[model samples]
Target: MDLFGCMNVKGRSGTKSQSVKFFILGEEFNDDAKKVEVYKKSIDLIKHGSPRGVITPIFVTYCSRFSRMIVCYPYFDESLSDWLKRYKGGSSNLPYEIRIMIRNLLAAIEHQDINRLEDISPIVCVKSKRDNTMEVKVILLPVQSEQSSKAKWRTSFSSLLRKNMHQTWLEDKDFEAFLLMLESNEYTLENLMGHPVLQDGDSNGRLILDCFRETLTPAQHKELEEKLNVQKYDGGDWRLRLQGKTPLENMSKRSTAYPGHDFLWFARKTVAHFNENDAKFKNATVNRVPAANVIKDLYPGFISDLYKLSLEPQYLNRALG
Candidate 1:
């Protein structure tokens, strides 16, 4: 019989490990049957989850009627083309509000180093079905070319050790750039290890090139710093400007900070990550955590407090309090 579903059975040793074989929907499979891996990637990514970003609901998981794994995604509510059509064929003299939204979206994409314009689309504006406030959203899809995804996005020591593996196709320079991204804390290394890959791994890995595309040569770094008189903004200054809205403010900060002398520290780190040798890259990567930690670190009791702090009376009270 064909396999339909399975469940994990823990061991009696009190430690959590799969020790019992799972039947397909409580039915046994033939001894010589071939098992298929379905939604292998989507399943793994759902487990690892994504980082804090301007994007949301990157993808969702579902099981099809036939009991096969399926990957589902939110529909693109509105494309850039749809918005431009409203202005009579992308002509100038666009509405001021629409212009600002477009500007902010472009800034976000640039800060994220996205290439294709289609990757971004405006999500439909809607009332918070629950709270009744206007909300805006956008989508930034990641690159998914087979060669790029396998060679540059995901890799492990075992994969690297394999002869004539997919990763072997990467050019020496591209490979070096990939390793540099991992070393610099720009890309978390934990995802490259065993178990479920990072939910945002492919996109983040793809963007690493954008982050490392140009390194600040010493002369360039010095010249920029001299121009700025070596000034800098700390968390306090950012907090005031951001007004406690960390996520929204961080995106703006990333865009304006780039190509500025005061942000040389970020640039220098990129240079350091790019120049590190393989040994150091691997060593430093060992201590890193995935991007999901960014959310948890910001709100320790997030899951438990989400509804309590977000829903009706609580949210209203806190805001008015």
Candidate 2:
């Protein structure tokens, strides 16, 4: 079972949702006993039910079929992607100050590590949104080698943890990045003008490298940033101004985000239990959430269900193994 898509979510009890729609689903490829075991293991991994929903793995369910897991996501007005396209990608382009604003927003994510601060990978897919710009969420999707019906995208931790677990986790890498992002003091890319977001219209990505050399620490900037500036990938258009390797692609301008779907990877990691648990099957990963929280919107219950199914460790382990 896998996430089908998002839907119109409604109502919640206090902070709890009344009817949350999750798209993650389950499938019939493995033994029932094995499936149950993996499901239980993952549930044990999750300790807290995120309050602010910042670095927490949201686990509310909307109801799903036997084949998959169900989740409930909030419905926001728009996505960060669309917002960027409209506000930044459009003719207006992003102002240097605005870029700082956005970069600051993304930088904030580096600090929060949900599990292990050192272990947290980059936040995955991002989308555009409306309403409150500050509300924009940097979606963290799962990283996986294969796709399946049980949690088409991936599964949920809430489902796994809900069953039974004695231990409790106070902080994780996701929370680490979340805190860093939230507490970021280095707003400047080089302290000169921040990370050189507003590039010359004719320039490639490399120019940013020089800026980083002056601004960011050796660790803050990635090798890809420099390499990409000099090279072009399958989908990248060197001629046209780039937007830091399409939201989904990895280090390549030409490739699409996450290769499968824009937000799929983000959904997978943040919500996926099996994928994250399996070190062997690494999910497509990005560096971190954009300072702007790029993507924001309610994920459909169908998609939530898929995540539940995907989180089932036994099924996913078999697939990955």
Candidate 3:
């Protein structure tokens, strides 16, 4: 398939945008019957099965004069290949840009999964508007069967990532972890947002929430905020909050055996101290729990203190004690 830019093309209602219009020219079919059948199928699929972030051609027809199938798509700011070239050396917003690209690609794959469309090879395009916002436009084509395997999809996405990001970006630990998750097909939009590298900061030093607020709709932003309940503390750590309490507070209150005893109190203090001063503990607590041995190695003294405190009168007299 070949994409062509059309400028000043008026609509059937005699309307047109000031910007250039773009359309795709598909390879010629065997005959008019084949062309008509493909065109109708494309239209019907788009009407009933089109997924968000995937772009379907606006108009599809057999151009008798040119004897080719023309698929007219909506206007897009630029092709992904061109955009990658423009930012070849990397940019301040490169990480965020790549995030958006991956997100859209996944969305396209989700579309394919839901509709059971096989052998799809996406022609990725982008729309970077003046407001510093971007939209990814995935044009799905039946060019290859590589999409059937998660491994192949990872390879394809990694190639695209290599085009837009620098070696340093790819080498980042969080990025590597993200790629691992992608390879395992364990990634989702929510997981992507909370991925350490993305949460760290964009190239321009903007935080994840700021990036999300700029890109997501108000409702979506609100939903995410409620779901994560995460806030960046002054110490530069993103902490998850429950209700109006910090993680330590929530954990402290969760102890059934020593609810209001000195054991729970010391545990809470230990958690708070570890959260603030211990790098390993902080990293472990960011989005998940550390292994038992890891916790023991890091806080043997604290664990001992809690154990000793648990034998105290207050803890021993507790209902579950």
Give all candidate RMSDs, comma-separated: 21.9, 21.5, 14.4
Candidate 3, position 138, lDDT: 67
Question: Can you write out model 3's per-residue Cα lDDT over 20-111, one digit (the tens) per residue?
Answer: 44444555463656666667656665675557667665567666666566666656666655665566554222355566656655656654
Could you say which candidate leads in lDDT? 3
- Give the per-residue lDDT digits (tens) of candidate 1, residues 28-55: 2111131222233334434544322233
TM-score of 2: 0.29
Q: lDDT at 70 for candidate 3?
A: 66
- Model 2, 1-321: lDDT tens digits are 343455644345455433222435344424455445434433432353322323222443324354444433334334333443454222222343333333433344334323211211221122234532343333222211232222211122222212211121112222222223223443222222222222221121222112223233333234323322222222343223224434333223333443322133333333232223343323322233221111111211222122223234553343334
Residue pairs in steric clash, candidate 1?
A: none
TM-score of candidate 3 to 2 decimals = 0.51
Rate residue 130 of model 3 by lDDT.
Answer: 61
Estimate TM-scores for all models.
0.23, 0.29, 0.51
Candidate 3 Cα errors over 4 Å, as ranges = 9-28, 32-37, 88-94, 113-125, 128-132, 142-147, 162-164, 185-194, 200-321
Local accuracy by lDDT, each model: 0.31, 0.30, 0.46
The regions of model 1 sitting more than 4 angstroms off are: 1-53, 66-80, 83-91, 110-115, 118-137, 146-321
- CA displacement after TM-score superposition, residue 209 of candidate 3 (Å): 15
